[model samples]
Target: MTIELSVLVEEADRFLDAARIQDYCPNGLQVQGRPQVRRIVSGVTASQALLDAAVAAEADAVLVHHGYFWKGENPCVVGMKQRRLKTLLGHDISLLAYHLPLDLHPEVGNNVQLGRQLGLTIEGPLEPGNPRSIVLVGAPAEPMAPADFARHVGAVLGREPLLVEGDRPIRRIAWCTGGAQGYIDQAIAAGVDAYLTGEVSEQTVHSARENGITFIAAGHHATERYGVQALGRYLAERFGIEHQFIDCPNPA
Candidate 1:
């Protein structure tokens, strides 16, 4: 079944409320293709490989969390960007991307789904009293050891995370996916036992150790894989369209 591209974007914007959120990039319909979308291929990033996979799948639209035209990125579409756009335009595949909005969604977001996998519900935002707090804090039914929690993360994401141990067992955990190590201070201020994010910086270790908070640098790609999939599933179900998640692995 085919759904209008505008309709898809409309529903997405309604759910994500992109207009309300302050994002680095445009949140919806980055590139237009065929008006009617029948098949959608979703992925973590809108890279060349993902575009190729979408083309191979005969997809009418490509939905992704990471899209082109970032805040500081070179806007001139000459080399890699040119090639990627050429492929999509050649095949008439729409590029639908969501950045911060995807992460902040309550139900089908990366952090939310990650919490679901670990049997935790979002109790509060890490930056409490803030309307748009990206870092979230939650606790499971029972607290587990920091090492055991790291194992659980590895098991769920299918990649071992780099661990920075804390002083005590993890009771309350805070997390934000996709290179959000800078939020370690916020987590520490929140007084959580552990902090989890995608990428880690050199200073993140020192911060974690000094603050006595466990830190886990789970694979960014792995941690971020679920939100786009969840959105794709929702789109498929809502619009009666075919959707497939094409995972192109990136260790970093």
Candidate 2:
């Protein structure tokens, strides 16, 4: 079945509530292509490799978690940006991206999906007041030692997580998918025993040690792959469209 590009964009925007929030980039269509989309390709980031894969698959549209035109990013579409956009436009492939919305969506969100994989039952948002707070608090299906929990995360995520274990067992955990190391303090404030995110900074180690909260730095790309994949599956089921998730490796 074929769906118009506009229709797909509308559905995605509605699913993500793109217009309601202040986001870093345009949430819906970043680049326009053919009017109708037949084969949809989903990926974590709209990097050149993902675009190349989409082109190789002869995809009509590329749905991604990270797209071009990020805040604080260079506006000039020259060099890599120009090459990427030109390739997509020249091949008539549309680009649809979702950032925070993908992270916070209750069902198919990154944080939610990661928690589920790790056997965590979501309690609430880590940041109490912010609806768009990416950090989430959850309790394990059963309490596990911090080291054991870290190992579980490593096993599920296909990468050894950097563990900064505290004395407490891990019953309540706070997580923010992707490079949200800065949210460790917020997680601590929420009184979570451990905090998990995709990447870690030098300060994160010190913060975790000083604050007495366990910290785990799972691979960024590994942790985030689930949400977009789940969203893609949903779209496929809902729209009866062909969807494929293209994985491009990023160690960080």
Candidate 3:
């Protein structure tokens, strides 16, 4: 069964609760396209490559974790931005993006998915009081040595995660998907033995060592691929629409 673009957009917006937060870019329907959507494509970003791939796939709509018009980005749609928008417009492909919402979703979110893949049971958010906190705290279902856990992350993510092991076993772990090294402090405050995120900055190394918390810099694209993929699969199964994930690699 096929669903209208409007209907799918509404469903995705409702699932992500896009109206609840002030995001960097428009959370839903960044670009308008055909009314009916039979094939849906998903990707990490709405770059030229991804948009071209979606167009090539004859996708009616493209869903993504990153989209055009970031919060602090220039509003003018020029240069690369213009090309990206042009591709979507020329193809009549609707663009739907979910940023923070995708990261924070309880069941299918990146953080939760990563934790589940690593056999971790989430205890709570890393931030004490923020219900929408991006950082999360959890414990392994069974204790694993720090090196072993690192190996597990590497194996599942298909990339060797950068490991900064502290002199402690990894029982309590904290994580935030996608370049959230700034949350290292929050993880430390949560009393977690280790903190994991997609990308790490230079200061993150020093901070981890000083704070006595182990840190792992998994690839940003690698870590975040799960949430959007899970969401697309869920939409496919529930709504009976064709869904495909277009992988555009980003090392950082």
Best by TM-score: 1
**lDDT agreement with native, every candidate:** 0.91, 0.90, 0.87
Superposition error at 74 for model 3 (Å): 1.9
Better-scoring candidate (lDDT), 1 or 2: 1
Best candidate (score: lDDT): 1
lDDT of 2 by residue, 38-151 (tens): 899999999999999999999999999999888798799899999999989999999999988898898999999988898889887876788877788989888889999988
**Model 1 ranges with Cα > 4 A deviation:** none
* TM-score comparison, 1 vs 3, better candidate: 1
Ten-residue region with minimum lDDT total, candidate 1: 120-129
Which residue pairs come into collision in candidate 1?
none
Candidate 3 Cα outliers beyond 4 Å, as residue runs? none
lDDT of 2 at 141: 86
User: Which residue pairs clash within candidate 3?
Assistant: 24-71
Whole-structure CA lDDT of model 3? 0.87
For each candidate in turn, the TM-score is: 0.97, 0.97, 0.96
